[model samples]
Target chain A: MEQSTESDICTDPVIRDQWYPLRALAELPEGATHHTRLLGVPVSCGVTRGRPWARTESAPGDGGTGALPVIDTYGYLWTSLGEPPPGVFEIPEYTEPDRRSMNAGSFIVATSAPRAVENFLDMGHFPYVHTGYLGIEPHTEVNPYDVEIIDGEIWATRCEFFQPMAAATATGGQMSKYTYRVPSPFAVMLYKSSPVDPERRDVIALLLQPMGHEQVVAHNFLCLLDDVNSDAEIKRFQQIIFAQDKPILENQIPRRLPLDPRAETPIRADHTSIVYRRHLRELGVNYGVVPA
Target chain B: MIRLYDWELSVNCYKQRLLMALLEVPYEIVPVDFFPGWEHKSPEFGRINPLGHIPVLDDDGFIVRDANAILVYLATRYDPTRTWYPVADPELLALTAQWLMFSEGTTNTASAARLHDGLGYDFDVEACRAGAHRLFRVLDEHLWFGEREGRHWVCPSPHPTIADLAIFPDVALSEEGGISRVDYPAVRRWMDRVRHLPGFVGMPGISPPLATSPPSVG
Candidate 1:
């Protein structure tokens, strides 16, 4: 399987445009309640509950005069279900870049977390935010250097070491296990190759969704685990994994934080951190001493 | 048989139960306990509703999740008389839909928050109170000056429709959260008319469901 840079969204024009308006509007008071032209069409901002109007100065031309738009959320229900007006919003059409191909082993992706993606790219303040976790590491230590471009996909290498010593007296058997941490905090992907296909490996994509400001929804998408299955089984598994993450993340206070990559030291164990930070730097985001 | 996943104490849930009772439809009640998490976040229950919210009615096999959906579904499916819900009139349906949205979008959340906060259940009182007042002012301004002779709220002609059935309970119970329901005389009177309907069943403040639970079908 090919490894790809996770922070690709920063360079993606579609993501930047869609995210900017929402981020801007969410900050505005009653912003959720206002009728605004999103991409040049009047779309009801029902989520924020008119916070934008409350915060900003509404001039005479604006609807916030003595006559505020009916401000009825009921009307929004119809708008949400109906088709978008023609030419109302510009839909950016971007295709995935072509990648160079190579004869490789079968790759199985494991459970991955989205929060990890959010944390990795966020290089402004991680040391303080996730003090005990992957925070406050020196820039050089967390750098990704073994960059290789294969079929338009990026792959990097780092030496991973593990201590091994375990024996069961009852069965007189020895147990050996190796754990691999992904550059993303969202998951720890361990590659397992079957005996027949020694070069083939599987990956896990663990997802972590911060459900609310203080809550999180985490799940592991075990790709290439089994062949296509029944929808019922798939739905059940998804619900179970999603449900497990709901309570754990919900109870966490201050669920998210900005990542800062300075004022901290990195040990040999910081191999994954290096690759992750390099990926963030490539996207022109903040990387500690480097300001963007 | 129609089965309602409802909490008797909930005015929102009560709307469906009242509709079922008034329509005289035989159904079963599956009580949901908000305390020990009987229905809210259970995985088994989550399959029934991905959002993990309540007042789900299973009419035979067809399911209606939200209270407003349940009200509309029951009225359309069972009430042939159309006395409770007139299906033919678009204006009436639209008006009813409008108020139902008001009740759910405005009144329900605010009033319930007041109840939860006032009754010592964990809820934000200041936020909830402000929300309650915001909605109350709208309802009051409309009720205080709007045209009304001696009929219930938006029943159209001299009687209560499904709209009234939808709005009446929450408006009446708004006071339980320390809200001055008496401020809006029109709303208060409308509340009385709704309560006095034949076969009317009050929430009775949290009761245990019987072995043979009553169905909450319209």
Candidate 2:
């Protein structure tokens, strides 16, 4: 086994140029200001008369009113440290009129953003970490999922699992179908079966802000077409799930995730994670990920 | 009228500022150069707080020295709702006091590490970081189970007490000190809940919640 060193991984420039969620749209109230650091740059976001704007202080721009591009979409404030490619990723499900949009809140993880993204992509831990909720012991089998890289995006389809408590309003066990998509290095979204209507799926997006080499803030946005549970109950359900994964992710040695196959052993269940790592490697995202 | 000896970047000062904002109490700031200026060490400033600290709160000539102490005093006196301090309920009050002390541990470790990194303060940075992580792990577990039990704050109260304000600044700013909250997802969620509080204010490095309704995804 080869050990990955800090020198083996360097900050990749490609990650900074892409847009990531800075704050939820609801977080930036009219006339209110928010300060955060994106890809190690100071950013201040504010709303003016129902319009939200973000300015990177280090960038060549005037104070507050500068040449910074800010967009409000999918219930989040999206911005980039560098010139973003055109626009943010589009989620057609967001256009659905009946979907209730919720920002589950932002989380700060000590590990690299890549590690957090990979964890979000993994379903093997569901049985142990989210026991009796997302999964249970007897239902540990993970059917092979189809993965593909289309137009610089990683997609995992046909993923299914038996979830004990699929949602806050869930009554009993049910098979949940899921499709995971990695639109950007630090952003991942999942279209999973809705607890209320199994035929319908809910869109959950985890947008991460890479604070540094080993630090990230994740913004969780959920678009669900559910008629039962209140928004608060839904938020709490997601919060509990994320809380279980935090300790496991942080305790992983090397802080930065390793892309090298030899760095850590993987089973068939990590197919989505493997493909996701390959895509990251193709993009040269070495900032928070060790090189192969 | 209340007056606070404050520093813009000090997490301790932020605790007082945050609580005052939450309580909607009007207080004037007596700015102290806590960093390179070291105004807190000056004789004139020392009289206000002999301990050479910022966030010394004075309400009608009654002086409160420490950050946690100031939170208790302001919440007890200024919070007309009587929910911030929770003195009416003995069990809840005890838990608040316990967590307030926990905040002191974070100050010594997390805030101490920040002082060493940001202001060139002399201290064992590694030890401070280690101490902070230990404290954060405990807090994360407590909060994780608290969420399970349907309790949001440190105590069982539906509303947040001063303990939440007392510990939040240090935890939120732990990254500057090289302490990561990544392992503490429950703590991270609690941070958002704290930021969402009405009239919540933030200091440098501390972010306030967005002004719209929190997202409700199932």
Candidate 3:
């Protein structure tokens, strides 16, 4: 006999509060065809087998988008593969062109604006959260020089030579000077400041959207001087950067309570954060601060 | 061979199924029984997932678990060149991820709570109500701010992405779960764009799957 417990799958300490077994709610005897309504949506209890397939629906032309709505079908069997379930569709392996790769002097990383800005400014987090990844010197500074809002999107300027950043700039080194535009507060854009002579320049762009508060969808884009360029190296580089950001960013709790201001200590290192926080406060945006 | 562990009426499961249909991927379906505690805890079933959850996908030899992860894998590995996975800026990707998280983590929770409580399930009605209120309020605020900026809730792009696909089902079905979506006109408009997608799928009326008679294990 096989038994499934809520504890086995739902590892999240918080989610466990509502982790009742589907079987408990279904009211059917053990070893029967099981089904339960989770959050009001109907689903078979559990078990999976056979190849994947969709439930049959009428052809779209038969009526319209309103008719013949789509649905999924599940059947359970067995398998020897130790592979995990498919979370998203897969992309076929392909050989990318070199000129389009990182050799083209462009790279892209996709992450949320909050996480991105925090990473750029919070030197203390890098050493701990992104260990063996980025280092910061004791005297590192993240000075904000300018802030602008064009058509509802925000662009800010900061001078940073925290660590490897200095080395990257010394060699014809441009700091991470880029324009960040949030078309909607939910999405953010970061691209190199250099222009392509009244048209374009080497650019790396990332788009982040929320799947849910805890989960997010991110994609990487490598924009180049020429639209026809191709490169596998840049793609690999972009993916590596994404992999690096994933662990740290995902670990951040979006809704954590704010620290106590009265008992708090402020220092010179927090000058940049204070300025940014005050600006947002002036705009009446609640950056997770509690009232005194 | 493609094997899918899915429930017939789930919007999240439909998300994956819809993609397969749009991409014309061939797959075999496996039905799991959730009612009588049969499939979920069977020794045979436990082998696939000890958690005993549905919406599991089994590829030729590889298995992908989470619904969003499966969607990302499909768009990337199967339809990389398709407009579905745009070759835009990294911001677009971040923007999409943000919405996906909102749908699955926030909207889904509220929507589900409304359904369970409204439909007479053993739900914590007060808790559900409070949760829904908080979640919808954030969305309402975002929309209010968006309107001030001459935009709706769409991300930073001129077009839509998987972000929209990720959120549409829950937002549309929210009304069925006892939510008064009329208050959020912007969300309604945002849903209109989602409905117009090339291969959009809508949630169906709530009803249990077929009731099969018992079979003897002896």
Best by DockQ: 2
Question: What is the descending lDDT order?
Answer: 2, 3, 1
lDDT of each: 0.43, 0.79, 0.43
List model 2 lDDT by residue over A1-292, tens digit each: 0112334232466876888888777656589877766665566798888777887665222234344687778878888766678889889888889988878757666678888888999988888788778999889999998998888889999999999998877899889999999998888999999878777898888888876677677777889877877554566577667756765776679888899878888899899888877787888877787789
Query: Which sections of candidate 2 miss by over 4 Å?
Result: A1-13, A59-66, B1-218
DockQ of all predictions against the true structure, Cα-based? 0.02, 0.03, 0.02
Please, what are the lDDT tens digits per residue for candidate 1 over residues A49-91?
4332212123223334232121211011112111222221211
Please give the lDDT score at residue B134 for candidate 3: 67
Q: Mind giving the per-residue lDDT tens digits that candidate 3 earns over B1-218?
A: 67777654456666777677666777776655432223556677778878765568888878877777777777777775544555456766776677677777544466565445322244565565566666667776776676667654456555555666666666655544555677776666566655554554433331111234221110
* C-alpha TM-scores of all predictions: 0.39, 0.59, 0.38
**For every candidate, C-alpha RMSD to the true structure in Å:** 19.8, 14.8, 26.6
DockQ of 3: 0.02
